[model samples]
Target: MGLLTNLKDSVSRVTDRLFASEDPKRIGIYGPPNAGKTTLANRIARDWTGDAIGPESHVPHETRRARRKEGVDIERNGQSVTIDIVDTPGVATKVDYKEFLDHDIEKDDAIRRSREATEGVAEAMHWLREDVDGVIYVLDSTTDPFTQVNTMLIGIIESRDLPVLIFANKIDLDQADIDRVADAFPEHETVPLSALEGDNMDEVYDKIAEYFA
Candidate 1:
């Protein structure tokens, strides 16, 4: 049964990719705040296009708007894939301005950023349903993987039957555990890497070329 199931899945993926349209696949980077979503997206851009998608900061909600780097050309094992990198703002159920103050942001700016972050989350949710062809779900490996947001995100992704790659980011941390992340989302594939150090990025590229291209 397991072998038959695997065979069926393989055939489905091949059929899906063969019928997939257009030149550039839209790959969205999504996860909780400070999960290195933008950093990874920028890393992919830098690898392919000699540029970063957007500036990244330590402050939560720093990326309060969706950013896209279009037409990033990647070639792996003679298989070429053009991708539009969509770096979305963090997904969160609540946005409190006071949290921004911890990052040394002023009250007024924090409040504005908070509002924008709320809107950004909504926009990210919209893109998950409406725009993306595939998703890279980034998770801070040092943190516990079980969370309400993760459940919602995964459920939505699965419902759409979209290709997903769960990224267990920040693996350089002493407490980082890829097993925890894999156990948390056993239904999907997870790649462990340190986006800050550019570790194991080739695996990500290879997965994109193999599964999403």
Candidate 2:
């Protein structure tokens, strides 16, 4: 990491530690479609609550509505925090039934999915305004980090003044470049992990216990 990057991360961590609260917080799992938002949510829920929030699929817009797993108590080495995990629908600028058709979805189902996905986007934004304490923004590290979805999401999170911890998910992939994501958003903390393979999951638990506890 560059000196500037290192400095920003250091400052952010110190700030989080200084503001750490005792009460449980509602932390949303947010990101663009197919970026492992649901995967990460389920992993955290499974470990802390013995349950999964929602299902995940390679097909986009699988989660058309928000799913909540309440009272997830994450404890590590005596440090712990209880959180309500809200696994929201994927935020996307556009949703087309044709895209689903490309995945071999039936026409009727595709249309319904597209409609629900569009509604889901609006609902996710609503939660940001009404119901959230902190957020875990999951990003696909294998793709370009400088996209409209990512930029807009970061801006919204900043505008809300939320404590965000960005996860550079899918690091097990050969093309993943976590540094690009970290450089793109220097103000927040970024931890690289593969939720599918369960790599570096311990760090995720530790971060939640540290920052959210």
Q: Lowest lDDT 10-mer window, candidate 1? A: 1-10
Residues 1-213 of candidate 1: C-alpha lDDT, one tens digit per residue: 277876886798888778878768899999999999989988899989999988888999888889999999889998788889999999999899999998888999999999999999999999999999989999999999899999999999999988899999999999999999999998788999998899998898888887678
Give the alpha-carbon lDDT of every model: 0.91, 0.88
Q: Candidates' TM-scores?
A: 0.96, 0.89
Candidate 2, 1-213: lDDT as tens digits: 588977776688678666857656889889999999999998988887788888889999999999888889888897657888899999999999999998989999999999999999999999988798888999999988788988998898899988788999999999999999999898778999999999999999888776565
Instruction: Kindly report which residue pairs in candidate 2 clash with one another.
Output: none
State, as a TM-score between 0 and 1, how close model 1 is to the true structure: 0.96
Off by over 4 Å in 2: 1-23
